[model samples]
Target: MIPRMGAGVVRNGRELVKGMSAAVPIAIGYVPIAVAFGVIARQSGLPFAETVLMSMMVFAGASQFMAVQMATAGALGMEIIFATLVLNFRHFIMSLSLMDRLKDVPLLAKGALAFGVTDETFAVAAMDEKGGNGRIHPLYMAGLIAVAYGSWVFGTVVGGLFAGVIPRSISDSMNIALYAMFIALLVPAVRKRWRVGAIALIGMALNALFGLFLSGGWATVLATVAAAGCGTMLMPREEPPAAEKTAG
Candidate 1:
């Protein structure tokens, strides 16, 4: 059964409201960025329908922006698909992290809830102490997603429709913003492992070399696969902790 707040027992709808409240910050941030994506997409030659559909279906903000940028860079359709898959591989870890918290949820409920998980949503839900003593209810998560998702789509639509009024300079710069985000995400991991930095440069170099001869997106796809395979072989495996290794 879903947990409740207060003594007398609150309704499920109330939990959803709490979730919406929690997502306010995410909505605020998403709107401007999403709006920027909208304007950039329109300026980048994506039609309104495709722009909105990408948001609606993909729902991963960083990957969406990257997709648009890659398309602009002459990446082929298959290359774009493969790139997004590699980038979003982190979703596997995120989903696994939530498994314990939502373990008892029915499979269908789990499926619905998983669809709503994002970096923001996961962070919010992980820290949230709602639903009685640090538990998260499916409904609350649903509410959180509803607001965030709506804001993203709404901002995309607004930007797409208003692309003309927005300065061409601003929309053009959004193409570069996604990589800035990537750098921010990359810096922390690079700090942990120099191999990560080496692997990244290797991928970049490989792409450049391959792009000289390959067409469409195959160069990027091949480069990514090759770099990742090298990382797997070169990066050291993490051993079990000393205490855990000795416990049994």
Candidate 2:
């Protein structure tokens, strides 16, 4: 038992190293955007501590930005919570999918893992699992999450601290960096799957239409749901013939 436990520890350590290495690109991508978020949150009247706290607790970039925007616009607490919830609904789907890959993990570990499962981390883990025939090392995932989380928190602190030092014009321009980061993530996925591009366009159009008559958060929620429904309906699925199943 002692030998076996020692081997397990060694294996997990190696896996952690690999996970951290794989997370370098994600860390790099998160820094500028997180800094931008920090800057925006600070400029929008959030205290430096609150800005960092949001990054630590919320962790989702888009939702954090929306929360900051809503808060700055004097939105009510309930409204802010609802908007954040709506925007982060995708995390539920991502977490469910990841659960299948982590069936052998303990509930406590799974809970911790769920908190770190951002879009970028999900993408990386999914690809890694696929390439490894569905075997993802939990320690590796922990390492990946640690690096990404640390980078985001650190970036937010740095941005918040420098918010006063940076010129107003430059700080305002940092807002575009978030959108550019999103576009960078989206374009590659759309290129790989044409359906993704169609869904994105549909969402954009619907959001625009809804924006004309509704609140920003509600418009976003409705457009997202509509686009997802359309995408589900349009997605192609293959069905094997009855004869093929019988032959087996």
lDDT of each: 0.84, 0.87
What TM-score goes with each of the models? 0.81, 0.88
Model 1: runs farther than 4 Å from truth?
Answer: 1-18, 127-135
Q: Report the CA-based lDDT of candidate 1 relative to the real structure.
A: 0.84
Residue-level error in angstroms, candidate 1, position 172? 1.0
Please provide, for model 2 over 87-147, each residue's C-alpha lDDT reduced to its tens digit, 9 standing for 90 to 100.
6888999988887888889999999999999999998988876456696888888999999
In model 1, state the lDDT of residue 169: 78
Which residue pairs clash in candidate 2?
none
RMSD of 2: 2.7
Q: How would you encode candidate 1's per-residue C-alpha lDDT over 4-83 as one tens digit per residue?
A: 35432565778789899999999998898888889998898999999999899998888898788789988878878987
Weakest 10 consecutive residues, lDDT, candidate 1? Answer: 1-10
